[model samples]
Target: MKSGDKVLETAGILVPKVCILGVTITLINKTTEYS
Candidate 1:
């Protein structure tokens, strides 16, 4: 159970980080495209 909790926590952190990174990259791409 503890191991499962740890995996869930790790995934929660990683997923958000990946999402934020993806959003940042998308915004940068749009900005450069418009520029």
Candidate 2:
């Protein structure tokens, strides 16, 4: 029960980190193409 809660918390944190990393990668790629 408690382990499930911990898993959920970690997943919540990981989701945003993954999203930021993806957005950052795309931004870098766009900058590279333009410059």
Candidate 3:
């Protein structure tokens, strides 16, 4: 149960990390295009 909980927590953290990473990548691409 503890391991499962940890995995769920890690997945939760990863989901946001992935989202932020995608946003950052898009922002970088836009900045590069504008510049």
Best by lDDT: 2
TM-score against native, each model: 0.84, 0.82, 0.74
For model 1, which pairs clash?
none
lDDT of each: 0.98, 0.98, 0.97
Highest TM-score among the candidates is held by which one?
A: 1
List residue ranges in candidate 2 displaced over 4 A: none
Tens-place lDDT per residue, model 2, 1-35, is 69999999999999999999999999999999999
lDDT of 1 by residue, 1-35 (tens): 69999999999999999999999999999999999
The ten-residue window of minimal lDDT in model 1 covers 1-10
Winner on TM-score between 1 and 2 is 1
Q: Which stretches of candidate 1 lie over 4 Å from their true place?
A: none
